[model samples]
Target: MGISRRATAHWEGDLKTGKGQLSTPQSGLLDNTRYAFSSRFGDEKGTNPEELIAAAHAGCFTMALSAKLTEAGFPPEALDTEAQVDLSMEGGPQLSQITLKVKAKVPGIEAEKFRAIADDAKQNCPVSKALSAVPVALEAELL
Candidate 1:
């Protein structure tokens, strides 16, 4: 069976100055959280889709890296991943690329081996798979 998660959004008014709210019933992590055109396109302070996508990608990649390390018997002591989603508007608004920066501390694992696992996780994580159309670049460090 496939696991399913859900979030909902409500928007009012036109695209440029419209206001929106996003919510996830199960987690309530985004309970009526605000989003707006300025927030998405300008420097206004509010959540945007790309930011949310970056967060999800970071989380998914981190977990995937942990799984790979555990499977290889490395079992990382700690892993931190940050994903940056770049939006472009040359033709139209679209996600152009995603960059993942990962830092890991895994006892007794060689740097080369850890790099290979990190690359694999970046390529095969669920969020990476879902966003496969967009380019993904990874910078991994073993600490």
Candidate 2:
């Protein structure tokens, strides 16, 4: 069986000054929220699209990396990944770039081999494939 996730967003007012709320149905948490162009352009206390993409990219990349490691007979003890998504306002919400950074601690793996594994993960990751139009860069470290 396949698992599913759900989230909902509600927005009000104009784009330049609107406010919104996002909630996770499974967790019953109303944690996600948004407000105006102000935050993206120049303010805090609000969420933006790039940040949300970063979250998704981070999750998807980590899962992909883990799968790759397992397949290569070197399953990671732990994998820490972060994604930074850049959005260009000039191009109207275009994904300018994505940076993926990973730190993995695995037994019996050389640093060079680990780096190669991470590169494979980055290339074959579903999120990376989906964001193929945008540039995806990776930095992997074994510790």
Candidate 3:
């Protein structure tokens, strides 16, 4: 089993005018000083939900693509995934769109096949599952 990770956040004052600290139990880099709050959701340098979602998308897509590539007998030499989450003020706090881009280097694999595999990963990654309410677009390339 993988090791568990923990992060804690502390907030002072109200949600809009308050400040907060985000810390990780195991990493000093996530110390209280690393996070702050501002009028923007009561945070200054602290990351918000959208940033977290984009990070999740990047991680999930990379792992899913790796697994899919291995299962297809063309394990990737390297897989780079990035996600851009767009938060538009349509009606509520909604994820307007997500753009996923992946660049993969897999020996002995055709570009089209690699792109298809990445597409499948995009559709089935855990982040994708968790974000069914949002629309996700993909731009996959194999090098």
Could you say which candidate leads in lDDT?
A: 1
Per-model TM-score, in order, reads: 0.98, 0.84, 0.81
Assess each prediction's global lDDT (C-alpha) against the native: 0.95, 0.82, 0.82
Ranking by lDDT: 1, 2, 3
Candidate 2 lDDT over 1-143, as tens digits, reads 98888888888888877877777778885466654577767767777767777988889889988888888898889999889888787847687889998888888888888888888878887777888899999999888
Cα lDDT of candidate 3 equals 0.82
Candidate 2, backbone clash total: 0
Q: Identify the leading candidate in terms of TM-score.
A: 1
Better of 2 and 3 by TM-score: 2
lDDT of 3 by residue, 42-136 (tens): 44556766777898899999999999999999988998888999888679667899999888889999888888888899899978998989999
Per-candidate clashes come to: 0, 0, 6
Ten residues in sequence with the least summed lDDT for candidate 3:
33-42
Summarize candidate 1's per-residue lDDT along 17-98 as a digit string, tens digits: 7899999998989999999999999989899999999999999999999999999999999998889999999899999999
> Clashes in candidate 3: how many?
6
For model 2, the superposed segments whose C-alpha errors exceed 4 Å read 1-3, 29-32
